[model samples]
Target: MAIETTSFESRGERCAATWYLPDAVGERWPCVVLANGFSGTRDWILPDFCRRFAAAGIAALAFDYRHLGESGGAPRQIVDVGEQRADLLAALAHARRDPRIDPRRVALWGTSLGGSHALTVAADDPDLAALILNMPAIDALSGANVEEKRKRAGVSRARTVAITLRLVGAALRDLSRAARRADPLYLGVYGEPGEAFFTDPELAPRFRRVAEGSPTWQNRVAARFLLGAPRYRSGTFERVKAPILICLAEHDLEVSADFIRAKAKGAARVDIRTYPVGHFDLYHGDAFEQVAADQVAFLRAHLGPR
Candidate 1:
């Protein structure tokens, strides 16, 4: 199998992507359109799953949302949930147009926030053959107390202060732009304790590892996303008519299984699997293998032969 670097347009901006193709030749393959979590890039651990999908005789297209990673968008490092969904739709169109892909069997797979987008897209796109979601952050407005735990995560005071000041500056800059209906402020995608983009200690090491030395990975996002997240709901899981596989982390501190189930109750066909691992753990090691196997089986069952 060979991985090809690629790009496609979304709302006139280029969205960078990678295409993983299986060895099967002359046959149009069933493809999976993969989108990454919250401010995540295609290169950040997603290649592992995409490789597995290719190994299972499927093609996988993992893409970065506009304004993030290698995508072409101004006022970078922001996560507008709506824009990300639109980017996925654009990627779907790109996949459909590819001669190597079987548009009728194209599937959608996403993780974390990207999972939310996958469900949202599947809700409206009846042509999709299957859907796979991992630890989906279904409700952007999930007013959880996890922030307190993130605040308590240990980080050097000097670094924290520096990041905090930078966030404040970015916020001010964004405010000025917004007054004229210009671009919003940019903030770090993740930071240590007492800083904006903060994640808990349990998740920080993994995030930092995924971010290290990645050419397309940026440590920033639009600060105004904070204001819109609470109102951004991806509860369309119920509206999805495709066969859906939802993987939940048993010890997930971010998204609750109960909440996910509540939203998915109305789905015509849903299979919920619980992994005895944390949210970030499924991106690697044994947990990833388990989930990837299940996903391949599900996709093969739903999408059929390559």
Candidate 2:
């Protein structure tokens, strides 16, 4: 397998990307365009999946969304869902135009929050060969059963309310700052209990481990994004015509497994796979192996050399 550094333009900003090519050269290969989850960079856990694809005779393009990682953008680490979707589309266009990739066989792969973008994008893109969502955060906040989620995470009602107030305050403050052309307010991506967006004590270390050596992976994002996040729902699954693979973690604390299962029921060509693990577990160990293997098989079956 071979890797190359590249960039693509998205809404006038340059997004950094890594191209993983198969050993067999001089032939166009089916490609998968990969995007990371919430506040995740291309370097975090995505390289492992990209390497697997390249080794399996498929090309993979892993990209960092603008304003994050090595991507070019000012006032960085903003997580705008709409802009991220645009970045994914731009990455798809870049992949389709590459001579080393089979334009007609380009697939979309997204994990966590990235999966939500993939699902929404694939809904309108009928030409995509396939779509793979790994432990996707589809509904996110809007359609989520917050009470159930909080209960599962052992978070009390008082804590949930407090978190909500903090999030709202931060978002409002960031919005005011934006209007005044000042720097955006930031929020930690993960922290000790009650200190960050994701306060899970056990998962915090795992996230840090994933981002261990990543130079561009920041542990924070613009707080203003929280204001528009709830409205950024991924409800286009039923509109997607391509073959879809949706991986779910039964014990996911970040994304509700039951919500995804219910939302997927409306889709026509979805294949659901459930694992006895949490959201972060899907990125490593036996769980990662099983999920990645299943994804490879799905991609190979659907995007065969053509």
Candidate 3:
């Protein structure tokens, strides 16, 4: 296997990427473009998956979204949904343009929020060979009801209300800063309930454990992004024509499995797999091994030599 450092332009910004290529003799090998989750860098937990794909005779391209990691963007750590989708598309284009990659056999692999971006991008580009989504944050695609979210998260109505108010305040502050051309307010990516954007108590430790060796991963994001999150819904699943593999974490506190199932019901070529673990579990330990193996098998079956 060989690894190459690369960069791609997205909306005038340079997005950093790494290509993991297999050592096989194929003139043009199948490729998989990978995007990281919210606040996740290209170096975080993604290298493991990329290595596995390369070992299976598939090429993997992992990139950092603009405004995060090594990518070029002003007012760093902001998570703009539209910008992220565009970045993924840019990565896809980069992979397709590479001489060593088979454009017709290029696929997309994403986890968490990245998965949702991949889904939306694949919906527009039907010619993609396949797609792999692991514990995708599809709830963002539909603007999941606040009450239902509170109930599922086991948080009281009052606590949920407080959290919303806090988010609004932070968003307003950041917007005001943007208007004044000042620094933006930041919010932690993981924290205890009602403390941060991702209010899962266990996420902090799990994220730390998974991102231990990664120096580029940041724990904060611009607060204003939360203001537009509710309106960030996408209705492109039904339009995606490529074969898709959806891996769900049954006990995920961030995104409910039922929400993903209901949204994916209309997609024609989807294979769903549910694992008895939390959202972060799939990034480490035995769960990671099992899920990664399943994904490799899926990729081989769909993107194998043709």
Q: List the candidates ranked by lDDT, beginning with the highest.
A: 2, 3, 1
How do the residues 1-306 of candidate 3 rate in per-residue lDDT, one tens digit apiece? Answer: 999999999999999999999989847899999988888898898999999999999999999999999999998998988899899999999999999998989999989888878888888897999999998875553534455547767888888778888888988999999999899899888775544677655465776774577888887888888776623244667888999999998877677788888778888899999999977889888999999899999999989777
- Give me the candidate number with maximum TM-score: 2
| Model 3, TM vs. native | 0.93
**Residue by residue across 109-219, what tens digits does model 2's lDDT show?**
988889888988998999999999988776657445577657767888998898789888988999999899899888889874444678766776787675677778988
Most lDDT-accurate candidate: 2
Clashes of each: 3, 0, 0
lDDT, each prediction: 0.81, 0.86, 0.85
Inter-residue clash pairs, candidate 2: none
TM-score of each: 0.87, 0.95, 0.93
Shift of residue 232 alpha carbon in model 3, Å: 7.2
For model 2, the local distance difference test gives 0.86
State residue 149's C-alpha deviation in candidate 1, in Å: 4.2
List candidate 3 stretches off by more than 4 Å.
Answer: 141-155, 192-194, 230-235
